[model samples]
Every structure is written in C-alpha cells, then in structure tokens.
Target: MQSTASTPELYLAELPEERQHIMTALRDVIRENLPAGFEEVMSYGMLGYAVPHTLYPAGYHCDPKQPLPFMSIASQKRHIAVYHMGMYADEKLLDWFKEEYSKHSNTKLDMGKSCIRFKKPEQVPLALIGELASKMTPQEWVQVYESQIKR
Candidate 1:
C-alpha cells in the first residue's frame, strides 16, 4: 500500500506494531551496509535510498526532479518488499542474488524484476539484504542506470 506519510520515520510509525519491528530491522540493515553517497529519503511513499541530485544532477531519467533511486524497502499489503534497482539493471547481480538467496533462507525466493517479497517477516534474511545493499555504490548505480535501464 502507498503510504501518505511525509517522512521515513512517520512511515514506519504508521505501520502496525508488528510491521513496525520488521520494517525497522530491514531499514537498519540497508542503512548500515549501503555504500556512502546514498541518501535515505521518502520516495514513492517508501523508505528509499537514492543518489541525491548533488551527486547526480541528471537525476532519474524517468523524472529528473527526483533523485536517482538505488533501493527501497516497504511494507506492502501481503508482504514486506525490498526493491533494488541494481538487481534489475544488472543480470550478474540478479543471478548472484538468486543463488545467494538459497543459502540464506529455507523459504523459496519470492521475487520480481527488482522487488524481493517476504510473505512472512520471520523469513526475511536481513544479512542477505544488507549484502545486497552494499553491492552497488551511488556512482555505480548512476552508471548502470544510464547505460542499461534509462531510456
């Protein structure tokens, strides 16, 4: 569900108490392992990590006014989701994640192009998510976005 909350803190606070804990843990892991240069912000109603305009004035090709998004975590209606733009843009990265997922959790990987869905909060692999967050720097993401995904 799209949240109307104005800030990440508010967004977390708005979730149900049980969800608040899961989202908070996931957010913390992403924040701790994410490379330098990514700014945490409220993007598309979720907790987003992006390359600020100062770092990439070109911004997002889809919306220049918005910072270039790198990753995001949200509590969706039926699951908690982690979205990594890098995984979508880089086939190697996607393959690596798919392989590593099996080593991290007993549950099958539930994923889409970029979104990793966890139907049960307990099944979420915080360490794996943290490693994924660290896999790309903002500069690297900008490069990938431009060369591969941007129109």
Candidate 2:
C-alpha cells in the first residue's frame, strides 16, 4: 500500500510484519547490486533508485524537478511491485527477465511494461533481479534514457 512514510525506515515499519522480510530482501538485492552514482530515496512513494540532479542536472525528462528514476520497489494495494525502467527500453532485458524469472520461480510472473508484480517474496526471483540490477551503471541508464527520448 502507498504510505505516508517519508523514509525507508518508516516505510518498512508501516508494512505488515509478514511482508517486512520480503521487502527487506528485495531492497537488499537492489542496494547491493545497484552501481555507484545511483542514490536511494523515496520517489513516487516507493523505495527508489535514481540519478541525482547533482550528477545529471537534466533530471527526469518528464519532470525536471525529479531525479531520473531507474527502479522502485513498493507495496501496492494487492501485490508487491518492482518498477524497472530499464526493461522498457531494452526489450531483450525484459524478455530475459521474464524467462529467468519463470525458470527460477514457482509463481507466475505478472508483469507489465515496466512493473513486475508478485503476491509474495517467494514469487520474486531474486537472482534475476540482482542480475538486472547489476547490469546498468548510472551512465548506461542515462544513455538508454536519452536514446529513448531522442526517438
């Protein structure tokens, strides 16, 4: 569920106890695998990784005031979600993510253009998430985003 919690600690505290461990594990995977130059912050009311303005200055193309978001993890009304912006640009990555997720997970992967949805921690494929997380450096993300914008 979308929360009023401003910080990651508060966000974690507000989640159902049963959900906390899963969320923490997913957050850990993102944190551990994310490249340098990406900052973790609350964005779109979720735990988000973004390209900070100090580094990019361009901000997000859609909203210059906001950082360029790479990914976000949040508890939604019915499911947990990880929004991976990279997949929208790289269809191969999206396909590979789905294939790997299916190979590793017992649960069906319910995904949209950029959002992967799952009911529980077990539904998530942590290894695939880590591989995706590790693949994009902030510079690569910027290039990908810029390319999309130019098109």
Could you list the CA RMSD of all candidates, in the order they appear? 1.0, 1.2
Give the per-residue lDDT of model 2 (tens digit) for 1-151. 6677889889998998878988899899988999999999888789999999988899998889999999999988788899999998987888778777867888767888899898766787777788889988989999999999999
Task: Write down the TM-score of every candidate.
Answer: 0.97, 0.94
Stretches > 4 Å off in candidate 1: 149-151
Tell me the tens digit of each residue's lDDT in model 1 across 25-118: 9999999999999999998989999999999998888889999998999999999999999999999999999999999999988999899999
* Clashing pairs for predicted structure model 1, backbone only: none
